[model samples]
Target: VLRLYHAKNVYYRIMRQNVLLLERKPEIPPSKRAHTGKVAVGESNQRWCFDGFEFSCDNGEKLRVTFTLDCCDREAIDWAASTGGYDNSTVQDVMLRSVEKRFGDRLPDTPVQWLTDNGSAYTAHETRKFARELNLEPCTTAVSSPQSNGMAERFVKTMKEYYIAFMPKPEVRTALRNLAAAFTHHNENHPHS
Candidate 1:
């Protein structure tokens, strides 16, 4: 046989303190939707992944970058780099540039998926609205989960290993210039298997 005791009584004895002094709090619920697992698409422009990365220069100046990549072709479509923190304006600029690069003056014929993590810039109300206006669907990864956006994460790894590792980044101007070349080379020369 078992005896049931009030929560307060059990807590008071276990903690050796007055249970009446303790206050219970409600918990935040989890999302109803499931996490996005695979980050690949069958065709180009069907989906694009966005992510930001940062590195420091030889002089100890930090450079941050935001980039968009086509899921199917794995092409680094457009990017923006700055010495400032990642912000909504920078994300919007990259979105506009990526659209211009892929579809020119006209927007995409169909809405393209814009997958990213739940970063403030990507999740800002203005940013989502702007993406909708541009014929893009902004979708964020699961909270505090990076693996859901694996393609972009892998791209960051490749860039850090192949390009940023050896490129001369003595200053911001030079680093930005090199970054442009790196993006071009990534699209044109680097092969993805």
Candidate 2:
């Protein structure tokens, strides 16, 4: 048995010669926006992304804002704010309604797809049931890989940054209004295209 094993010994070797190991994925790494690979954004309008954010209120309460983004043109196709939907079912409901309003024409036939992180809300039963009911396909990213849905992540980051830095953080209603105003400005004048 020892003699036979000795005869079959072969050391492991690198596979590709053109793309060297040292040349792959640089040491400093690119930003999440740069690292994001091609999604079939131009193939169809069915692809979507989702993320949630918390807005600080004056009364020590928080309002949760959830948004759905279309991968193409990188626009916020749907968004909802709630004082109660800190869970998956509520989040899914708002998202579904947004999609339904915009593309209700497709209804049962359109192959809608959504991408998100492994948030508990993303895995809720109501969300699962709704996706099946609407014939939507759901894809989740790796635990640490937020870049898979980097567009959505980027939007959320922008919202938090601008909303806090520019808008006057006042009472609940004023803050909400400011946020809405900011989003409108972002959508209309930012020229992200």
Candidate 3:
């Protein structure tokens, strides 16, 4: 009644060849709609988004930064800095703290309707549990589409362009901090629309 394709099967080999020639891969019918990014139509911050970006230290080491932002005002609600030792815990902690900072005693009632992303970090069981504990919804973006998480992606691009890209790599954390401080001033004070 059904056919299965294993590694050594002719069907599998043919499928692999087709995949190599095709730029896009297949998805489940249920996920087909997300491929068009129709899930969170017209959503923005407080309805949050999260992502991790990698950076290189001057010591030739790597670091990861996890950040969360409100979809409405585009404000960075929280962030955490970690090196090669990065994991889901850091992201959960920072996000929870951010929500707490924003809503305080009302944190429980805060409607964080969406934590939108395509990042694996945003899909982790721990991440989901944290969001569930706080009553937030988890949403994934269309596969291979960065535009689904455009706001957070754009913020990252701006930070790298103005701070990281021009700096002397990652050994400049204090300088990076200063740049971030300046950026916060400009981001909140400059009246971006």
Judging by lDDT against the true structure, name the best candidate: 1
Tens digit of lDDT per residue, candidate 2, span 92-127? 776777667667756646766777777888867778
Please write out the lDDT profile of model 1 over residues 1-193, one tens digit for every residue: 1335577567768776644455667675765643357889899999999999999988999999999999999999998888887799899999999999999999999999999998999999999999999999988888857778999999999899999998999999999888888888899986565
After superposing all C-alphas onto the true structure, candidate 2 shows an RMSD in angstroms of: 10.4
The TM-score of predicted model 2 comes to 0.71
TM-score: the better of candidates 1 and 3: 1
For each candidate, give its TM-score against the true structure.
0.84, 0.71, 0.70
What is the TM-score of candidate 3?
0.70
**How far out, in Å, is residue 114 in model 1?**
0.5
Top model by TM-score, which number?
1
What would the TM-score be for candidate 1 when compared with the true structure? Answer: 0.84
Q: Is candidate 2 or candidate 3 better by TM-score?
A: 2
Candidate 3 ranges with C-alpha deviation above 4 Å: 1-46, 108-110, 168-172
| Order of quality (lDDT) | 1, 2, 3
What ranges in model 2 sit over 4 Å off? 1-40, 105-108
Ranking by TM-score: 1, 2, 3
lDDT of candidate model 2 versus the reference: 0.70
Where does candidate 1 stray beyond 4 Å?
1-30, 33-35
